[model samples]
Target: MTKKTPSLISSEFFEPAKASEQVAPKETALEIVARLEKSLVGRNPANQQSPRPPTRVQIPLWSEDHRPVLHDLVRSALFTCGQRDARMDLKAKPIYALEHIKITYTGEELRQRDYDVYLQILHLSRGATVDNRQEWVEFEARSLIKMLGWTQNSRSLVELRETIRRLTACALEVTRSRTKSSVPVVYGGPLLLKYAGAQEGGFDEVTFWKVQINSEVAAQLKPGDYTRIDWQIRTKLSPLEKWLHAFYSTNQHPYPMKVETIHKLCGSRMAEIKFFRRAIKAALDRLTEVGFLSSWQLDDTDKVKVVRSQMLTIQDRESNNDVRT
Candidate 1:
């Protein structure tokens, strides 16, 4: 009798271990206020206009974390946490979150793996000419796989192609607002404009693949709007840890939030809150272990308090530029 072989691609594929946090140890009263003020300004610049492009659109350093603004907001549920079902791809789903935001995701039920692929595509686009038509950032598949930290193999390559297709096929409709009176801004569109491999053959036969960043989403990647994820630390976390990392990364100083609320916000599939609560502590612990978090814990009231370790936040970077002026 023939037996089925177990799949090697799992969230653990990217799970490795590491540690450190950069919480500012000492801060004068002035610095505290400065950070807070900067935080508020950096909060959500959805209402602001896109900055004018320079003569040459130089791609920022690949090391910088230029995440999609919508992904950052819907992160709690944008990519489902825990192990994913192999068959659950290309399905439309609604993620319930705070009233201030509504995100409609239609396409592949993105997993953490897809998250890497989407970001990798964007990172590669930094240097490529970008537009609505998949002026896809081009590259050789083997090198791209190695960069994603995936094992180089035919299966990995196949998976990489699917990852890109998933990214290409997805559409996001995100609505965000700071307050009821303030005008709500609608943002988002297809996560990607289009994508394809070199002609004659599909991904399998193409030596170079092209992936584009939806021009609309690419605009939001302006300086203050995006978060800088520590890829080294991020690559080492579990699905839950990665989600939590993004949720917290968007907030320079995370406030106390109910574990229950987080479970809801993260769009957890775990049927019970109690199970998610238990799982959360472990995930938070992983963040702390990896230095993405300074410290975190469930308090007596059941609200989790998180302190982040950041060498410099987007606000901090802008603040330095101001001081130089």
Candidate 2:
């Protein structure tokens, strides 16, 4: 036999394969897909976009127990003096007179609208600290409308401007009687100063305003001098009801007052006492219905005794059923 080198091929390849022998299987498509999915377990999709965050709406938190001190005077019709029409050189006689004190409105007699503006100004500027007599207090037009529960519209804007004009033009005079002599105090400067610049589009608008509360008037507003009127209830009340609410709120412990006394204090224009009594009774009823009064009664002595409720301090939203006209 010839001496040949051993063949590189295995003996098994040269021999016939057994029927039970098997070779390793190739990976299927499903197996490949599952392996790829497992690799991507902790990762975010490359094409996904994140959502934008929501914007917050700003709602002002108004004080429930604080209003302007001027509310005491303006709440009543005394400032208006029951004058509906504007007068030239209108000077009202002393509308209210108490022991050693007298109050008079000069220039144009204020109307209910004028007092409304004055009250809003006082309410907005309640937090201001007067460093000097000439210090100016500023407020925004948008804030004024929102606080007064007015719609922001063209007509409302015009009316707001007109209100500012009236308030700045009106003057208040107070005369005090002393043991030996009487002193006369006057507030003659403009109550407010308005500033509105032209927009880029050449449109004129009243963006905001500045006001100076008279020093004498500001003195009366020191701590413990202001009243808390329920503005939510106030906006819905008629003129008479609003006045009664303001008047009674200022008195911490109200005493029984005669109807005649209330009528005089209210400075009502009604000619007859009987008519005034009826109107006043209606207003009181409204107040009671709104939970402002525990009870009120006219005694045999013709005196009106009012039992005030602590609702303003206790309740946040009073019933408005009686306030609706």
Candidate 3:
């Protein structure tokens, strides 16, 4: 026996529309076609309202001489301390933190030096917009190297160029680890939108090379949201020391953090936690030497305690040493 295929209108259903009950079958078909045509026309790229151009994202010119580091960047390990090859995972990785200073990163491993390079780029772009569209900043890379107090020789120039390339290619996202707070800003952007330079000149030509900051990043640059650090002091710091400075700069009232958490915070690649402790000790000492920290020590609880230069150092006399690495 042959089987019948199922249909939208079953044979077992009620009677069809009578002559008087006719729903104007041909007109109904026409109406359906018209409705479908309307829908397809509505979806057609040309028929719908032209998409509004992306609104001009113009941030005010930041006129400070000090380097403006965003809290989003300063508090997290988006830029790592160690020279280890940090993974290129596109998924956001949770950065270890205390209280609610949680941050997550999504990008290639950014080094400590990348932070400096990016900040310098930000510095250059500070004068770029209030009405600027391109957001391009011009500089001869040799001068930029010297501005950062880096050597201005040929080799160093090439290294700086490569650094710019790396930063331009890499993107990152920094968001609060928790949403309990009223903070609404979450930053996500590449270090640069794009850059133009000659391989031979290394941005040292008469037509100087230029770099553009992504508008998304620049839109967040405003007063009261960024920390201004002394560029001279930053230039003197090592990779790990630089990371330490930024961390402390963001925390006005410093609290003792676990050595292990800090290890994860800076994205340290030290195979052993003990090695990170030693490096951290040396880094804190450097910070003290540079006057960013008045003093820092590990307590018996294995948490790092730090006193800033402005804060009075309350020396703890009862150090029965449990945090010594």
Candidate 4:
């Protein structure tokens, strides 16, 4: 019982081309070779065109004096208050505020990275052609990743998204003192109005994101008060170092600040004063090593004395100091 294999085609008579049959044009060897080459390179020979050069991505440069414009509180630890992971809901009486200003962060405690994200947003916003009513800005994820000197990876993208979310979720109740009356005017708003990313895909698929700065927050970004930070040096420093740099950069002539004052300003949750002092000392040492600070030392009273580099001063903006660390 041998089984027969089924035939794929029916037996039929095939006719050769007749003399009257339309003859097809034959391609020359060169034409055939050219077509083959085109096909191999993923081009249609029929519609072949000259190849274009790779596009040059223009990255905006950081102006020597261009600083991130941030509200004093935002620049400080009011929003990033407490431990890196602690959820905070703080009410504090700032010197400028007539009444206690409430600050809250329910999710992961806002950290130095979150503040960096905010500053980066401001940096990007400054470059954009913004109108008076322009409350929102759209940025390509790739552009931001490149600007921040971050590795193009899923983890970085996820962290970026989370940082934006934290900014949008955090809220502040700012109290402004009125000259005419003793009444305190309270202004409350989220750091960001909205944040949106690609819905149906991964980080690679998400091309851009849109973020809206809250009106109140936007108002505080006026030119005169903004401090221009050296982001190149900033990105290289530790969290505490970066914060101290920002804090001191705002002042024209930085005075000797107490470690306790700095600890409070940094919103550190270190339970022991000794630990906080050590952290501050380490940060200052790094700053000094980086040339951002000329020199720094602790006095007998435990107050930290810091000498600002000419680069950190607006008076001598042209001075180029070596920031090695």
TM-score of 4: 0.65
> Candidate 1 versus the native: TM-score?
0.71
- For model 2, the superposed segments whose C-alpha errors exceed 4 Å read 1-65, 71-77, 81-89, 131-136, 175-207, 311-325
Q: Kindly list the per-residue Cα lDDT of model 4 for residues 235-289, writing each as its tens digit.
A: 7787788778876666545667667767766778788999988888888889988
Query: Quick one: ranking by lDDT, best first?
Result: 3, 1, 4, 2
lDDT of 2 by residue, 33-85 (tens): 98877677537565244664332222122485345434336433455335444
Off by over 4 Å in 3: 1-65, 84-107, 130-132, 177-184, 201-207, 310-325
For each candidate, how many residue pairs have backbone atoms clashing (under 3 Å)? Answer: 3, 0, 1, 1
- lDDT of the candidates, in the order given: 0.67, 0.59, 0.69, 0.63
Lowest lDDT 10-mer window, candidate 4? 316-325
Top lDDT prediction, candidate number: 3
**Order of all candidates by TM-score, from best down to worst?**
3, 1, 4, 2
Deviation from native of the Cα of residue 103 in model 4, angstroms: 6.1
Report model 3's TM-score to 2 decimal places. Answer: 0.71
lDDT of 1 at 296: 84
Model 4, which residues run further than 4 Å from truth?
1-65, 79-108, 127-135, 176-186, 199-205, 312-325
lDDT of 2 at 104: 64
2 versus 3: better TM-score goes to = 3
